[model samples]
Target chain A: MRNLWLFLSKYNAFFFFIIFFSISIVLFVRNNSFQRASVLNSSNQIVGKAYETTNYLKSYLNLAVVNDSLAAENARLRGEMKSAFYSDSIVKREIVDTIQHQQYSYIVGEVVNNSIHHKDNTITINRGRKHGIKKGMGVISPTGVVGLVLNVSDNYSTVQSLLHSDTRISACIKENNAFGSLTWGEENYDPMVALLKDIPNHVKVTKGQHIITSGYSTRFPKGIAIGRVRRTGVKGGESFLNIEVQLSTDFSTLQYVYVVNNLLAAEQEQVEAIQPAK
Target chain B: MIRIIINNLIRFVVLVFIQVFLLKNIGYYNLATPFLYILFVLLLPFETPNILLFVLSFLLGLTIDTFYDTLGINAAATCVLAFVRIIFINLTVQRQGLETEPEPKLGIMGFRWFFFYTLILTLFHHLTLFLLETFTFSDIKYTLIRVVLSSIFTIVLVLLSEFIFFRKKER
Candidate 1:
């Protein structure tokens, strides 16, 4: 018994290492699973507050660029206002359109923490559950699609950026309606580029063609710009064309984004659940 | 003894803040990222208990992870680094040397020894970090590039910080 005890004491450091190493590995594996919400994330109060304070300090550095983008977006929005169009009908009649119902709403959120270097990048925003931001909600900047909300606390949320390896957004080529999915962290590690997969070789894809959201899922509205096709190639024995896209939203300078609130999300999910399990 | 504890505690907070706030924003072309927090682990006193060393390293990693939103990756890498540190110190630093130098610092250990130590430890840490982060061999080439580039970046920053802060103490 003494010999056994002495032997165990001699190797206690190795055991401690094994125990701690395994705990870290466990945490890593659990974090990879989609549904599990972790408390040790950036949305925690202290970390979020620290990021918020730092973001406030850094926000001033990009004021000119942010102002320019805001001005451009304001101009585009103003051009679409009812006041910009003139009624051409000889007999003008007021018609109340009752056919269309709003399905998506936008909640403005300021990005406090953003990263593009890692294999799976995450962005932290100021809006959270207190502001109606929830998991799986789509987030987009003024220019293009951003990411999906992965976790939410009272005053902050973390977004799984489109740069993440596992993130896939349903997208289509604007020119030919070639349906495919946009993903990142593939062959090219460039933050500005992503891979558009499942596009059939038969589809006529051209360089500089616009890629937009297909609206197949409830996360985003249809026709939101995603990127421009940079190149297209076909690997041997593969039926799908390897399409490279240059993302529109420059994540390195992302300062603000809008979290999409799908009003009919619950209804759509309830209806989709009616399908029998295969 | 209390002074040592206080110094390390202050270092822990300062390093974590610098890592997540300052260095986090500085990455070159999504290739080179400088992780300066591991300096805390590398500079721990030579006489620190092995168990305490592992615990401190894990905590430092977890703290950085909370801010970075990468839960276990940094923790795992730092744990590996701590283990490597123990073995390296045992092999290179003699028992008699511990009496003269209380810890491994650039000023205390000389430039060449400290540089090699930082280079090897940083390489191991980055390799484990990026490998576990990508978690696949499919894009091994890109992962390798990130590891090599990030290691160099981290080494340069570590050496620079060492010279800037610890150079005066040597004089």
Candidate 2:
């Protein structure tokens, strides 16, 4: 008994280490497939709002630049509005109807931290659980889709920027309705790439053709302007067309984003989830 | 003991802040964010309890994984390093009977020995981490490149930090 007790005591630390290691492995394995919820999510609404305040403070530092851009946008919009009114009466009617049939309300916030450099670039916004921000909501700037909200806290939320390695936006060509996944390349931010697989070589793709979100996903509503095609060509031996798109939003300088609150998103998801099994 | 604990805690906060705030965003030239947090594991006092060391290492890795949204990669790498630490130390150092404690900072070992020691261990840590991250051998070339790039950056940063922190004292 004395010998056994001595042996046990001698190796107690090693045993404890093994036990703790096992516990950590088990915990990690169990949570491997964990999805984000409001509670565990980093972008919880309360934190989102707090970050929004911080973002507002940050914007104060760039007020002059923002004002200049806003003025430029105003001029561009006015010019487009005048030409668009005379170009087509049908387009004007559709625009009016779209305004009337707006699907969801928006909660405006400013992006406090934005990065275009990293492969998994994320944007931090000031808005959170207090503002009813939730995970998987779509975020957009005036130009186009910015990203999707991944995590939320009480006063801050983190967005998986469109330039991220994992971002998969549902994009369709405006001219020909050809659809593809718009993804960023590992290279520098010269021209963003899109993988338009299974596109027939015969399809006429032109430079500067507009690309917009397809209504297939709930994260983004249809008709949000994404980007324009800058270049396109057929892969040497593959059936896919390699295309590059210039993003509408300048990720280098981002602020004043709108979080889309899809009021019926939960209901829609529930229905879709059930219908798929049926 | 209190000083050690406080130092480890402070190191933890500083490493994580540098990681998430600065290094994580620096995706220069397709290289990864260098992990210098393992330096804490490498620098623990020689006489520290092994079980406590393991726990501390796991916690450090897990904290990083939480922010990165990666599951188990850093923890697995850190655990492997912690497990092999004693053996590596034994192989590298011939201790006298009178000196019972370990001095973790490379300054104690002289430049050449310290560089070799840090290089081997950092390489091991990076290899395990990047392999786990890629999780396949099909793209071994790319994975190898990443390992090399990350290892180089990690080594440079670790040495730089030592230089900065150890400035006031002698080796």
Candidate 3:
């Protein structure tokens, strides 16, 4: 009896650790994907509000830089507005097409917290659920795609920066219109990589070719600036383009960003749900 | 006692705020982002209940995971680290036993002992975390590199944080 008591006392802590760990693992594994998704949604909401408040305080400090970018964007927009006029039916059709392609809404935010050095980094902004910010909303600066909304609270939202390994954005070449997946190279902050598939050797590519989203995904709209090709090469048994892109945004000094909301996103997703899996 | 509890609570809030707000964002290199949140875990009362310690560590990790969207990776790592912390503290100081003083801090303990203590524990924390985060040892060489690089960053940031926030007042 004495020996048994000593043995139980010696092993008690280990037993406790094993028991607690097993229970937590069971809970984590049992939830399934949809339940995890919902938890992510709620956490995203709370984090968004917390980040948004922090962003609000930091935006005030970064007003000078933000004002400069806003001015530049405004000037570019005004120039396009002037050139929008045309009497010809072809020109009118082109104008309507441009308008349709340019469909986007921008909500301004500042990076209260930004990290580019880590393998995984999150950027928090000063906008949240109260401002219609939701999980999966794309974050952008005047320069390029920054990240997507992961969590949102009442007044702030956290963005999963493009630098993160988990972040995947659909991209296409401007000249050839070939689609590929863009992801951050874990080592760097700005320059990103794209995995392009099934492109023939005949297609001539050059340095600094513009790359944009393919609009195949609901996360981002077409023609929104992504980056420019930094390097082009062939890989795989068949010919494919391995492109390196220099992101327009300097993530190191990131400040104000726009949280984008697509009003038709939910409806579009619902309609597309019935399609057979490709 | 109430004042002491309030002081600890205030310290917890301040440390977390500074960690998430300022330090998390300031890493100039890929491996430089530090986990200053461990300061809360380190500063907790030595006599804190074992179950309470585990629960608090888990909650702290969950908060960070929520922000970074890394699932339960942080929570799992923190729980393990918290469980091991008591054992390390006991093994190292059991010869002399714990003081009647406040909490663990470098100033309270001598320099070299504290340094080694923090280093060994910090390495353990980072190793478990990165391993869980990666979930594989496919790139064994690269994984080792990350562990070393991230440990240096964690150490520097933690030391700097201790200096800045935990300066010992004249007794």
Candidate 4:
């Protein structure tokens, strides 16, 4: 205390000068226009740059969450695609879902067992009654109609493969409605070809024409793509056309299939029973 | 001792009034403010205490600022002047009259010594004040012009007043 007082009294003039000089400076800064403008401008520039950097960092941090939501949304929309159904007449605009009731509801399942190399090939699916799959329900791959469900358990079902000998399906050419009974012979184990019979020889048939299911029975829907016509010939005096078809389903890589849930299958079966033999 | 105090008080008032009301009002040459008030600092007794000298000079410059609406430029310059005035007198005046405190008049301090003293100190005061006011070297030319013109005028005025009034005191 004593030293400080001594110093103050000794350099009292210098201290007083400094005090008064500071006061003058404060007043000058408050009053001067140019100094005020320069101070505010530089300070604002620094603050604005800091805010912009923080905003950039915030957006970068949120990018992962944004990407996750986009992937989930794509998965949801894939389930509602028109090509995944038994009908292609419905166009894929946004949600005209009110017009489509339960004409077809598909139970998606993976093929647990597929035997394409055998003469009596059969497929085992990982879906059954618990998933609304029943006997006589049609199954299909993304590219073509596969077969009908023959038996069911609690959690599994068996489908008669289109590659089997006794299996027969009615098919028609897309261009001309010249339908025939589709069959695979005992020797037809190539897994890529089938035969369409009963097409009249006089009916015009073209190679490379698309063949689709004729919906003659309650088993499958009409217009389900079966395959494409690969070859057509009439033996010397045969009354019917022998047409070879290339199966659209690539059996070697078959993994997923959808089982059709026909809402009126029981009613249609009962109505068919009363028809007399033609 | 009382008479010296009274005389300095009178000189302080007279110089401040003349600087604020008369000299500063006339914008002579647009660059020169004939700051003859520093004459008070020049004429203060050589033996004046350092603290008192600094305070007197600060107050003198602040008084001029209040009139001219300038806040700190004059106060800071005058405070520096007050401090320098003491060292200046000690350097210029001889040790022959060591015991007695002689007034820094043209008669007591020889004219040659006083002229140089006034010229140097006045230039210092003008430099400090103008530098404070501009506060930048970007317009150094303008600062230099203001200091030179104003210092020359202040030096002449300080010499004139000393010759006119202090001559009567010396006689």
- The candidate that achieves the highest lDDT relative to the unseen native structure: 1
Span of ten consecutive residues with least summed lDDT in model 2 chain A: A36-45
Cα lDDT tens digits, model 4, B1-171, are: 788899999999999867744564343433565789999988888778876887788778766654443556677788778756766766766777745546878877678988998988898888888787656787777668778988888888888888786653343
lDDT of 2 by residue, B93-169 (tens): 77672154346675665677768777888888888887776556877787788788889989999998887766322
For each candidate, the DockQ is 0.77, 0.30, 0.37, 0.07
lDDT of each: 0.91, 0.72, 0.70, 0.72
Identify the leading candidate in terms of DockQ: 1
By TM-score, rank the candidates, best first.
1, 3, 2, 4
User: Least lDDT summed over 10 consecutive residues: which range in candidate 3 chain B?
Assistant: B94-103
What is the per-residue lDDT of model 1 for residues B63-166, given as tens digits with 9 covering 90 to 100? 98888888899999999999889888888998987877887998888899999899999999999999998888988888899999999999999999998987
| Evaluation by TM-score, superior candidate among 1 and 4 | 1
Q: CAPRI verdict on model 1? A: medium
TM-score of model 3's chain A, to 2 decimals?
A: 0.73
lDDT of 3 by residue, A156-238 (tens): 66788888877888888898887778877543444244333344666777898888877887778888888887887876655
lDDT of 2 by residue, A1-278 (tens): 99999997786655655675576566556544445323422344433444455556767877887787778768867877856555643554534444464568788887866666444567877777799899889998877889898777777888988877667888888887877777774333342444433456777888999989876788888878888878889868776787777777877667788999987787788888875444
**What is the TM-score of each predicted model, taking all chains together?**
0.96, 0.78, 0.79, 0.41
Q: Write the per-residue lDDT of candidate 4 for residues A1-278, one digit (tens) a residue.
A: 99999999877656766775676567556645333322221112332233234434544554675466446646766877965558655574666668766766778876654545434456766676788887778888767788877656666666777976668898889889988888984334467899999999888888889999987776677888898989999968989998999998876456567887877778888997897878
